[model samples]
Target: MKPVRYTGLTIAWWLVGTPVSAIDVQHSSLVELEAAYAYKTGSWQKQEIVWRPEWVTRFDSGARLTVIGEGRFDAKDKLDPGRPDQPFRAQNTETVFPSDHIDLELREFYLDHYAGDAFVRLGKQQIVWGQADGLRVLDVINPLSYREFILPDVEHRRIPLWSALTEIPLETWTAQLVWIPDATVTESTLPGATYSLIPDPFGEGRLQVNRPDSLADSDFGLKLSTFQRGWDLSLNYLYHTIDDPLIRIDASGQQVLADYNRSHLVGGTASKPFGDLTLRSEVGLESKNRFQDSLTGEIINTEVGSYVIGLDYSGFSDWFISAQFFQTYRFTGTHDNGSSKEQVTVLIRHDAMNNALILEALGIYDLNNKDSLIQLEAEYSVSTNVVLRAGADLFFGDQSGTFGQFQEASRLSTGFTFSF
Candidate 1:
């Protein structure tokens, strides 16, 4: 069998250490191992297993080096490798392989160098942005999977999973930055992984959006946060101008929209507590790209969308809750002729027996028309970092029967996750 090209890259990275000091795993050092599992349920059942081992050592000055190796496995209930003679259901004399177990994934590699409070990390990594949950208007800079975030995507959709980060701490505050010069994905990953960095459908990088050896993009971001005894506030700014997207979405429904045609982001968050209860809030915004209209013949304005105002309450030690409302208003935007959307969400969380038993509920409302979503969830901690969660999501309004983009009028799901 042909060897993996990236495995060689990992070895080369290990050989190249920093001033922090190098350790011969055969000689000196510290090492650690970690594993994680995430699963989801629904029409599609998915699961993922991540196993990694790491070695760390100090070289000289403030420099250090770390060798990280990771393996990922995915499994599904149905996957046809080939052969019409082979049934696409069972993996037997006539069964197809599930989407969950055909992976020899390498998640990370590379060395790290740090001098003073300044740090540089290179290799496969995950870049997380946005302080809000669910909707990610301004968080388009980094790659993400809603299936992984919201439900469960046993199918791994990897992105420009490598990059660098730097941080500078100051009195009472600090600054951080992320740079992803190379944003590529493994060729063997799920079909859901791809993007047109420009977020512009009719722009450059579309064809190479998900191809490897073509990760030519970067994301710049800054955040300033501090405390004032009674409350904490943070202001964030992000600018993502990509030559090609690290992550892209493919629309399969009726109103198939092109992957985001490139966009810009900006947002912030704040938190405070009253007596025994605590409160927090966040907001984000994005400016859409301008491209050819599918129907109209002119260069119409796409529009800049914004997520606004929210509140969270955690007054009781055994209970936690949050609520947020976001709407699409006009600003530095163009597509107002018919572009319209507005939503509201509410959530509640409760804990008992040291957070062993938990309950949660979330609901979404569509102000423009008749689209609303209601979800309820409950879970019991079977062990530390492991739990059984069950829930039902209900969709109401005219947009339910429409498949694709806004498919499923109502559905139910239950699953669990384990982290170790």
Candidate 2:
């Protein structure tokens, strides 16, 4: 991989030059140490430490500036091998890798202000949509990172972008608008990484990614939300480039060409609570989704519809239970076997010892491939400023299946976080 250029140094310096006396600055920091062992391979898969620091400067004029930075030291160096290429809008937030095991990044930096009845946030940030926990239906604004597959929390997996967001309150409803100039698509693990998606049968050089670089390729979206009759609802729309690439084989059949395509996403979400149970649902229709035919190796353009229905129950004290069903259907294009896919996810959590100790289990089963992933985790708050965590990830089913293909990657992990 080529070294990504660092173009954010000037912006970083400029932000640092801001006057400190005129603002009320609040600061916090945390250190996290984690390690994972792959039982199948009988080898250490991860040994890393991370430090995150954040600052919020609030001015008397009702304007606020926020900045967050992250540094990581990967002793095993199995997740992120190096700094990937920067996106067009993210050039000012580039990540720097000093060595094979050390990385420094400007995670988020943004300014917030209120203009009359509108709330505006400008700079690099993250925008989240939808109500699903483990599955994505209408939440396509920010791209994702698959370095750890889908095992990590959504907040940790989402890649932030450089964008401008505005929110306006009108009567009983709210409207939000987002303009993202960041051309950063999704970031995938490299070939030799632990969670690489590409097979080793094809050389690493055989896969090529064509990223959009022009300003005209920017992404934009709008959302309208309201609460009425004890129900929360939203209407969402986005015109942007899909993060996942469409794969196609070259003419010589020796190379795989992957490219991003633009699409229009129309979706909505609704949630309602009934006594102890809450029902949530999200649905979206995406236009011009491309998929490759496994038999003929041809790219097929089609409309895709995806939806998720979830039920959450919290009747029992200190116990929480949630289940979700997700599905995706192609209106035109079909795989060699079918045009629809389905998944089910269940999550259970319990808090013990007056909420000091917590235990949780999450299961995701792919109905189409008959594969599944189970995650078991426990967390204990040692003190107000410290917490300890341990977890196990298990995968099952045939090797050709999605989760089953990572069966060998199953692991046990433990970590601790110290906040100050």
Candidate 3:
């Protein structure tokens, strides 16, 4: 049977087809232009422009609707080298391709309604649940896109889903429930793309992906949150298919098979502030997790626990600093991929020139692999509606490490955004 495909255009058309002649409407738009130059290849890696338009309508009964659409053009399509034959299965159904260099998509469309002390939101939207910066522990409600290899902001990398979400206030505590029917998984760069993760030692190989496409495969989660005595805390639980695929080679070693598996996740987060510093932490345990053996090509099933601790300081004027430590441990699994992994990240930001200019730096280091990534950027406000940005991404370590594998892909970039 053919796989079931969900398209954003279907929901968009349905929304537009509804009659709303007596509602209040508000509209806004933004344009972003960016380019990057690869020092290793000595060529332009990307030259892209994006336009986003948004609309919001409010009814007298307190119901609201939001719609956002995005259009992109790439003159140098190095980052998204079109996979004509396969077409990158994850987002193909929701996105439209006008040409080799142009694409259009419905970014987000949702409705917000308040019923007494409870809130309901239904449609294609993003749900975030973590406090860690540049790291994901309990934020698995939505899958991610790795087209730029985690270089873009979180808002740009996350792929929204069609879901039902509601929040209920119970005294001093709030409970959130989410039901996601969209089966879109994480999107990895294709073979010919700049940041492709698949290795082709022998030659270019075929990749076959089996995605879940039934309502029975839907995902659901629950979260309870409360604040007491200057502390913020939440408990989260989710039962869903893991977004990352487990890749294995066929017996013939000519084709790669990628499949998804289900897991039960129990996690929690806590944060508190003291004077000029804030402490934040998150912990999660996955009941069933799968990892591929590097040497034998075997898939190992095991339980995994991961945690992160972060601290943010803002004592100094016009400056903010934050640091985080993250670790993952496998309870019972083959030792080929290591039993435990450690990582650290740091971020520093400064505002200058009377808040017209800003400088920021972020660093991520893998303790086990001894590889690291450093990012530095500066932004200048040209006016109230325009902002200019420049940055550099540097990678250091061996090719076998995570960040080290992208050493050659490091580059300098500049961009601008205009909003109105």
Candidate 4:
């Protein structure tokens, strides 16, 4: 997390409720959070506020070119320096501080050069490609923001990397592709419900964060799909070369060679609607040896391909009820070379209170290890664009055994989400 102070905050909303213009403002605070029992019996709870100003205007040029642009601004805790802090010292797992206040990044600024029913875009924009319940393996491209989560992920921030992607309709099939010259990785949050704090770039040498933002070499992929008998089939493939930082550190400690290869991911997921329930499932296998298959001096084995299987049911959207199960295993596991890890999660969801409340809880098990996890969640909408939420997550079964123990108990948290 960027260096910043956490105290009181200030925000202002310039309302322009015109049919073509919109603006919103909002704020919330949480006073307590939970960590392992040894860290504290509970949390000192932190507070935060965020305000956003948005405006949009659309025009048509002989119905050929559509131009649109939008601007957004964010001000939080030490961001304004006008508010004060709570009486005593507090412990916060939340990363909202003065050093990391949101800069009101651009949401969209592009022109649609439409010729018939298709067009090309040349500017900072969002490109989304995935069909799963947001747990995407094919969504390998796009800028990731480290700020928020929970809402639907329809897009990302404007990127300097221009994309030459398009969709062309065909008789029974369609063709699509996306390419950007300067591959990049925008810092992202690892699900706030799990933790609202930013982790160190390098912690005990975990490989997930160390993976290059840009896959060293440009990344690209292809997808194809078709519909039949209330059934649909789809396939996708992505290729790239990214370094593995942890591998390098480990090899240096002892002496070994490294061979990094271009990674490849080929997968397909399918779904169909059944009365009162939707049957959805996914299966995938991985391979990366084709690009880099050997290791030399200071070995950096950034190569891993895994297999996954998952199933979910959206039996109810009214009251919002859903259930899902997932399991992942790596065929090419490694540790000294690389090790395989497997995990599973059983989730349930509910939406009620005149459609004003949302609830979800998940039970997770690390099949590879004895550690297990439970997450409880709840959210209530105060209005169409305003919401209040609180939830906590608890982990059991000696977690400190890996990080070394202070306490091997829990990691509990709860907070709110609001948009204006």
Candidate 5:
């Protein structure tokens, strides 16, 4: 791993340049300390704990600063203590233990300035665009870490980028631009051969990943948004390196090489407010995307267009339901396996006990592959600063499909959060 250069220090130094005696402070600060713990059920039980702290400062000049820090402790070991003589297999080992031991992360450190009709933010930050849930269509600025799969909050999994973002108002419309000079791409944390959609090359003792380190691999994004009546619309464009890598087998057919391809995206989004429901939709076109052949080592180049449309209704009591239809179409070459690209996602949530308890369910079903994944969760607020949560992950259907490949990875999980 290479060292990542961030601009948080420079911004913090600039903000602290004011003299102590001449300092013109405006308001007091708010500080919060938080901790969380999660554990899985069954024999190969895995557990983790995290401590996080945050501080917010407001200045008289309409400038605000926020800082957050995190530390994680994992109790799972890579190799089972009882099976000392057995060979280490990627499917049975835990990467979080040895790789992430004593991990300390500066989750967020940013400063925001507002002037007239424009705003500017500097430092390491997460910029989210798009309105859909459980899937990403137009949110292409930041890479994500899926180390713990989908059990963690999506906001926590997003990797922040060191960038400068500016929002300018032009009459009735707003334009936003972001530039990320660091070519850092965080790949999804797939647990070797156990929960991955593809077989693990490491388990077979043949794996190689190639990464781009030059300035040309950086990213740039632009978005223009406006409102009409009760509807919000936006247009987005981004030129960046794909976070997910495509695999290419070597001539020996045993060694697999991973390559991060460069691509561009253009998309549009719309959100409308109905009587008792909210509707959201996104459409995007991706160019120069590459797919590989599993057996022949040939790379297939193709263009893909995908869209998602959904609506959320909260009319009844405390129940909220959301449903989305998502599909992708290829305009170029076809790979070895002729599979369809369509999936349906649904989310349901209910608040009970005067909003202190939440019960939620989410499902993703593949229309073509006939495979599905369902997750159920329940959370209760023990107090103003404490929360308890439990969940279960279930997969069903054919072995060659997406959700079915994780059939053996289902498990019951529980966790708690404390804040003060």
Candidate 6:
């Protein structure tokens, strides 16, 4: 069977067939409905309306179940037989595609059980780590979908991992262990998506993938955390597959093969509050790192170290301010030629009108490459159970840099959510 078919079956089994022993049940449930639309500027790069429905239930025994899904429809995806440039696009049925014109997804379906000081969670779920915004340091469990870029919350963008998680509380610290039985790989971009990172991006290609779905390819992670002297600290170790693919192009340069690298990560994080300000920092080292060579499309193995430090303050006029510095160093990578790259980000948010209106702004500056991205947004509470949101994404800098590659993808967006 094809990988996409296998993935669909896996998700179906987890959503409807995963079982656990349980006792008497007292039921509580919630349902949420959400819709959104976005329009790309200048060109028909993107236009779409997305619908999402989420539901969750809890039993008296402290067992919880959740189901979340989404469907998307794009204006340009409709057929226009008269126009040469306007073509009919088929909806995507695969769960993990690089991009989507029309698509349906069961984003998360999970069961959680707790007893005494121990807990177990099974099925597909997102496990978030680290405290930095817009940058990843120790948060490597789930692959992120960047189709919508960083406009969405990290939780919304994080691809759920199908795994089992166990947690236990000891006298001095809490321990968590995660086991992924069959890992799925997510790609960076699709054929005609709005954004492109590669120079002269290809419009058509085949991706031969090497994924961790076999028994020998499963992944594992362990974390220990504790609070001491007003500081929260955690130590982590992971034996997992990298989310980003290492690409190797054929001699023809039109066909590409991507593979996952088994890697080990050792990381630590700490956070503390000083009056109205909170400080956070995390650092990690990845041994046996792998990445694709931009020019040659060859995969190379190396070692890398990454770190992030952040500060958040909320002492001024109901405004929240956050600033962070992030850096990554290549110890032995073929790419970057053993050089380091750095970036800084600042975020500001404020609420007014009795907490009915919220304003937010975020800016990211690449100190090394001089590229930047800025996002501005506002959300208003139309009603007690409904919210209206609008935002814009702007990119600036050199074409070779990260944010600058999407200079033509900047766009405005709006959304609405209703909960019951």
CA shift of 350, model 1, Å: 1.1
Model 2 spans with C-alpha error above 4 angstroms: 1-21, 82-90, 251-253
Clashing pairs in 3: none
Per-residue lDDT of model 4, residues 18-137, tens digit only: 232213222322121111121243432223443333333333231111122222222322212322121111111122333443333233333344446544443334665545443434
Report the lDDT tens digits of candidate 5 across residue range 309-361: 99999999999999999988777645466533888999999999999999999
TM-score of 5: 0.85
lDDT of 3 by residue, 1-420 (tens): 012124443443344455544379999999999999989879888899999999998865576778888899999887767534332334433576678888777878787877788898878899999778878889988888788898888898888888889999999999999998878888777677888876554455577777877367889999999998998999999998888888777757677777888999999999999999999999999888888877776778988899999999999999999999999899976747679999999999999999999999999999999999999999999999999999999889999998998898899999999999
Off by over 4 Å in 5: 1-6, 14-41, 77-101, 190-198, 202-206, 251-254
Preferred candidate (lDDT higher): 1 or 6: 6
Lowest lDDT 10-residue stretch of candidate 3? 1-10
TM-score of each: 0.64, 0.93, 0.93, 0.62, 0.85, 0.83
Give the local distance difference test score of model 5.
0.69
Off by over 4 Å in 1: 1-101, 107-113, 146-160, 183-216, 228-231, 241-264, 276-288, 291-299, 302-305, 330-340, 400-411, 414-420
Better of 1 and 2 by lDDT: 2
State the displacement of the C-alpha of residue 173, model 2, in Å, after optimal TM-score superposition: 1.0
lDDT (Cα atoms) of all candidates against the true structure: 0.48, 0.84, 0.84, 0.42, 0.69, 0.69
Better of 4 and 5 by lDDT: 5
Question: Once superposed on the true structure, which residue ranges of model 6 sit more than 4 Å away at CA?
Answer: 1-41, 44-47, 77-101, 196-203, 292-299, 333-338
Tens-place lDDT digits, model 6, residues 291-349: 66676656667888999999999999879999999999877556434458899999999
